[model samples]
Target chain A: MNEAAASLVADDGVPLKLKLRRAERAHKLKSVAMIAPLFLFLLLSFVLPIGTLMYRSVDNPELHRALPQTVAALAGWDTQALPDEPVFAALVRDLRKAQEESTLGLASRRLNYEISGFSSLLTKLVRKLPPEGAGVRDAVIAVDERWGQLTYWRAIARAGTPLTSFYLLKAVDHRVNEAGDIESVPANEAAYVTVFGRTFWIALIVTLWALALGFPVAYLLATLPSGPSNLLMILVLLPFWTSLLVRTAAWIVLLQSGGILNGAMIGLGLIAEPLQLVFNRFGVYVAMVHILLPFMILPLYSVMKGISPAYVRAAVSLGAHPFLAFWRVYVPQTIAGVAAGCLLVFILAIGYYITPALVGGPDDQMVSYFVAFFTNRTINWGMASALGTLLLIATLVLYAVYGKLASSDANKARR
Target chain B: MQPYATPIERVWFYAFRVICGLVLLYLVLPILVIVPLSFNSSSFLTYPLSGFSMRWYEEFFGSHEWMMALKNSLIVAPSATVLATCFGTLAAVGLTRGEFPGKALVMAILISPMVVPIVIVAVGLYFFFADIGLLNTYAGLILAHAALGVPFVIITVTATLQGYNTNLSRAAASLGAPPLTVFFKVVLPLILPGVVSGALFAFATSFDEVVVTLFLASPTQRTLPQQMFGGIRENISPTIACVATIMIVLSVLMLLTMEWLRRRNEKLRGAG
Candidate 1:
């Protein structure tokens, strides 16, 4: 060894710094290179957008800015009784200023888009602003007529903020009562808890449907000769080659009232009239199962393919019935595949929005529908974010439970 | 250990075979119907062939919107493929070969795109891109599509690398070759097939994605699937059949290419 190498090395000839530095550099480079694309992608698409979406929850500029005078006046008021004249005078001043600056229209439009009746309230209040600002609170109350009502006071008090918790509260089936205290919404108007329940139920139904249809086909493919089995496997995978849109659309076309399914049933004389299949729960289930069946079959079939025939043969030789042998020996081996397929289908089904939107009845809509509703219609980012956060939590919990089950199953197998 | 060939067993076996065949046929029927309908001379999208012609294909080529969407998809899919392939291959190697704390958590984060609802991802991206003034730009779409594509590439490539040997790289490193040099010259050629297949998967994924594209892009920048979505919403157009037909053809070609590469890769691995 060279003198420098010998000096750097231990008596056993370890080149400490060079080896460590080289290893360090390699490891760092590998990690950076490996993770860079994912980081860039998430940063641009996933992270940035999610950040913006979450930020939109507290975003209140048009309202707070236009009504700054009114908001500032009402900031520290006690909630024991209705507001006094000064708060009304602040509203009149803010409304007049807002009208002059053309900011009132934008603020009211934004609010109306969120909750529906705010436009007329703002418009009427602005138009009837007294020549000398007299009866400011009563005049403000006179515009909507609801302003004098206790409910109106409650709404104003609830929404009386530069930043409102209204959307977030509504997302979880709770809201600020007239007293400005948070409470559960009435059972009739409570939407989210039921929506979440429906989401879980629909996903469960779809998972079971796919498994029911897929297991037999998967077993047949597993038992077939290699040549035919491979071809069949490709056939099973064929639907995946088409766009998901096309598959969903095809189902719509086939299931509609005047569509092929109705035509077929009528021709067969099985029904006197066409069934109302499309735009209903039955259509949603059918479409989801068709789309997700291949996912179930492919994994289950692959797992089943790896099982040795000898195990079943040995079981039969030991005097087990064929049915028992198939169940005890063959079926146990497919647990991994079944787990994977169920997990895959269930997760995909839970996130489904399009098929359900197109085919499901109004009540059949999942939690994602409301998430979109808040975003597109209400423009209520806080509610949308809260809903999304809830969904994320549910998904993570499901995954954790799945992981625990899978690991315990693995442990049981080892035992 | 064959079962007794009783009449009931034989009958049940035949019934099972017939049912399975019918299911397979059912699965492929809609896809198979698209090509024939694409050739329908009649403008209506129905079977029984009013006539046979290439008019739909001609129309697809003639229309500016269809062609523009096609152009957008062509541009976006390749860029996404390149991005996904690089990152996915790197991740596959690191995940399989490298040791680190929180490795499982990192891997989960990397694959979470696949698990999360597309609507959530899309709306989140919509708000995000709007915030950054990138809502309609090619850079935004490419990055969004690439993020969606990465999970598939990572999944396929990692599966491919599962059985690969680590000793060869260690041996090359022990002979005084730099790690980078060894990687490019030795490791790359060995894993090139996995890398290529991953790219194919990435390409297919981005090309087929619709939800995120819809929310993140405008009419002028809409992808083909988004275009088809608009067409379906706006009116009943036979051109949708032509579009679906073309997508099917391209996907079949791509699937064939991947399968061929897989076979060739196996042969090459065997020879090596």
Candidate 2:
């Protein structure tokens, strides 16, 4: 014991624990060194950009920059009434400078998001600003009556700050009322909530469909002999390997009103008339289910493969009916796989854009379609970022659930 | 196979198999239908045997727009694949070898590109690239694509690394080999199959990606999938079928190579 104690001390009189900790620190440093390059790259390329986009969701800097003097003059004015003449003078100054620089278009567009007619109002006023010495307030009001309204001035003042929740509120079909309370927009104007609901509803139905179709196939693949099962596995893997656009295109060829499926049905005399299949909800569901089936089957198959046949055989021999035996003994064992597959399909379906955009009718489009519309067509980055943020949150929540389920399953395995 | 089964059990078993058969057909039929339709002589996309021809394939190869898109795809996919493979393999190695705080957070950040919707990524990247003057540039597209492809590489390579024996590297280190030397000589060869598979995945991802390209690519930088999207939206031509068929063939080849590599990896590990 005394010799062991002596060995615990290093030759230079340092303790062994300290020496070991130093070595451990060096190892950790080396690992950090190895990871640093990719870490920095992802930070620059992925994380930073997404962060910047999220910032854009609430970023309202254009009006602040373009109408700086007007923003300052409106700082302490009561929002219940129209601003005084100083605010109007500030507006004239900002507008004259903006017109000189030909930058009135940008500020006007930013203000247009707050009120409908502000864009035309600002553009026209900039074109017909009266002489510099006149009373700028009445002159501005004369150029456009919108300038005399409290709501328009309120919008300008609200937008003058560096950040605002206008876009984010608009994303969920809510708005800040003139009383500064959050309330829903008119029912006809509420688009995003319905789109989000449709996205989830379709994703849920697709997940259920995939589960229904995948379970039987996974069972067969798990139970069948190696040679045949492997062959069948390739059939599942082939579609999984194909290009997504190609697969979606194939669906178009098959499901079009004059396409092969209708042709075959007519030829077989099953129906006298062709059916409307493509460019609708039916087509969207069919295409999504076909595309996501492999995701479901693969997970279930892996889990089923690990389950021994002895459990079901024992259940059968114990006087249970065959169906009951299979369900009671076999199905419960594959819950982990079921959860994994369903979560994957559901998450993927909710974010799906291409299939729905191509195959579905106008009303059937998902939230992502609108996100893209705002981005590509309207160039409304704020609205697009807000919608994207909501989608991101939904995805992260589902992923967290999956992570929890997976960890619990692992814990169960350990037990 | 169980002798204990009742008479009804056999019926249930056959019924299950039939259902499975139909599911398999559902999965494979769409992909196979595109192949013969591509060769159909009729300009229409439907069946009824309008004879056979190679006109669509000829047109695909001859059209300047299609050819240019193809050339861009070829260039962009390979470049993105190389970049993703290098960074991903390095990250995978570090993650598997290291014991560090906040590892899970790092991993989540790295894989976030995969979890986030492509529309979001495309929009985010569009705004970012526009701000930095990378809009419509090859460098911008490649960087965005590589970011998208990195998660696949990380997943595949990390999976491969899980089966690797770290003792081999330690033994090399014990034999006076430097860390880099040990990595190159002992570690890389064993993981080459995984890295190659990851590269293939990265390539396929970049090749298939259209949303980001739609947002970022100018007219001159259009890709094949971008062109296909436009065609599908505006016109239903047989030429798209030809393109889809070619893509399927390429995917099949890639799948075969991946299967072979997987078997080879298993064999190598077993031999070791």
- Model 1 agreement with the true structure over B176-233: per-residue lDDT tens digits: 8897888888888877777887788788878888878877777788789888877765
Clashing pairs in 1: none
How does the DockQ of candidate 1 come out? Answer: 0.54
Segments in model 2 whose C-alpha atoms lie over 4 Å from true places: A1-15, B1-4
Per-residue lDDT tens digits for candidate 2, residues B11-73, read 777787788889999999999998999999999988886999999999999999999999999
Tens-digit per-residue lDDT, A267-336, candidate 2 = 9999999999989999999999999999999999998999999998899789888789888999999999
Global Cα lDDT for candidate 2: 0.89
Question: Please, what are the lDDT tens digits per residue for candidate 1 over residues A248-312?
Answer: 66766667776666777888898989899977889889888888889899889878888899999
Among incorrect, acceptable, medium and high, the docking class of model 2 is medium
Model-by-model DockQ, in order:
0.54, 0.76
TM-score of every model versus the real structure:
0.88, 0.96
Runs off by more than 4 Å, candidate 1: A1-33, A55-62, A84-86, A105-119, A130-154, A160-165, A180-182, A186-194, A265-273, A360-364, A402-415, B1-3, B174-177, B234-236, B269-272
lDDT (Cα, 0-100) at A263 in candidate 2: 94
